[model samples]
Target: MLKKFAKQTLVAVSLAVSIPVFAASYTIGTGSQSGTYYPLGGILAKIWSENIDDFDMRAEVTAASVENTIKVATGKQLVGIAQGNVVLQANEGVKPFPRKMDVSVLFALYPNAVQFMVPADSDIHSISDLKGKRISLGAPGSGTRVSSVNILSTLGINESDVKPQSLNYTATTNALANGQIDAGVIVGSLGVGAITELALTRNIRILSFSEDDMQKIIAANPSYQPLEAPAETYKNVPAFTTPAVWNVLVVNKNMPQEQAYEMTKVAFDNMKKIRQVVGVTKFTTLENMNKLSGIALHPGAQQYLDEQMKK
Candidate 1:
């Protein structure tokens, strides 16, 4: 009888321990199938699943920044990626935000450039010159598309003036290479593999906005920063520079504080590894993560930020 009672007690204790194990399951909302967001989110998901205690996590490829932000805001996804400009706009109830989204910053994940690529033989020299040409503004609902619209708006070009093609990076690249499209716009980290590959495989030119035009763009959107896209960022791309913005990682307002804290720590702790995965520099620092958050930092992420600040 004594032995049987001990066995029952052990079984009860085991069940109790297993209860908390299944309590948490998380999903990360990434971007389209081929874009940078999907792969980056996948890496983060793997890191979280591997290191996070008693948590199950996975990455899902969605429409991209705008869609990902909505998913996080509405709790459809616990975590997601958003462009810095998009996050700021959404937080302030701008454009697609409709209502002020209660999303919080997990980290300023990376610096994404406003890469405007044109055919090697195209006469379009600046944003204004593309007024009458067929340009792939990026796929519908993507951050790239939104950025393209903003750039066009800066040049007094709206949807009505130019032919805007809604296509993904792969499709846009192919189209531009085959003379099917005159230009393609992409928002990606500095070393964009697709853009680099396209430049190497065929004749391509990186578009640049005039100084006055760049200033106009900056005035319109403060989140955009002037970045120099060095010649080495691509092959035979010439020593060209352009102004662009950054991308941010965001979480739903209701994400667990502890989970957010862990995620924040994981990002900073393994940032070296992340840099290898994504060509992000400068945005991963502790100071920038705290000072330049695209949206409100989660309470748990705040805790980590506080710790980092202290050190």
Candidate 2:
């Protein structure tokens, strides 16, 4: 890691330029401050800023996936991190998105597990038991909410049946710790910062979907695969079954092919920093580039990934 950082730093220092001081700017849309997206976006931005000259690149916090997808499509943001399922919906002209979003992929990010957690001593033992409880479904326009709604809808629960709280990961964990909510669902990587802190103070339960129901959900949504939250993720949290979806890096389809290629190349070449972001990020390598379906890959990104495959 130090070697790569030094190499990248030297490259930045060695570059000669006659370009304008304020060359251009770009943004990476990320999630709330408490979640993995925020930090991971920071790392990605760092990679770009260090390697790609004449651009002021930054990662800004926002409502995750759904918001990121729309921003990138509309050219409000240059690049974003979004859930695979949400991006597919945008690609297919699905509701919540009025028209097909013109977007292109760079590569897969990581798998975000649907973490449905509750106070270990709470009486909400199952999804059906959550009907009357105050639950944090996730922030508005986040992929976490999408997964929460899908889980509830698949299990025959309506929003009206329960008191819903649209809180971000940090707020959700805070609410749970303070007894403001009975349960919360966070779609994030394992070893997620917020949950880890919560577990140190309060024993938590990682709830599982029933075996039969899980199979049914997967059959309908192929983008979501079966996942298990192991007992080691947090202090005294038991193992449980859940669903996970891949998070992909995306950009506007209008981005130049060469720019896209440069971004993709820089990312994989400096993947050590990305992997250090979180455990799931280790999957964000050349081998996992084409995992998402439906969404088109940027031509430049496709070319670079294809070249790697031939090696």
Among all candidates shown, the one with the greatest lDDT: 2
What is the per-residue lDDT of model 1 for residues 96-163, given as tens digits with 9 covering 90 to 100? 67899978887776677888998767898777788878999988778999998987887799988988
Residue 252's lDDT within candidate 1 is: 81
Instruction: State the lDDT of candidate 2 residue by residue for 48-108, as single tens digits.
Output: 8888888678999999999999999998999999999888888888866899999878899
Clashes by residue pair, model 2: none
Instruction: For each candidate in turn, give its C-alpha RMSD to the true structure in angstroms.
Output: 3.3, 9.0
Give TM per candidate.
0.89, 0.91
Q: Residue 12 lDDT in model 2?
A: 76
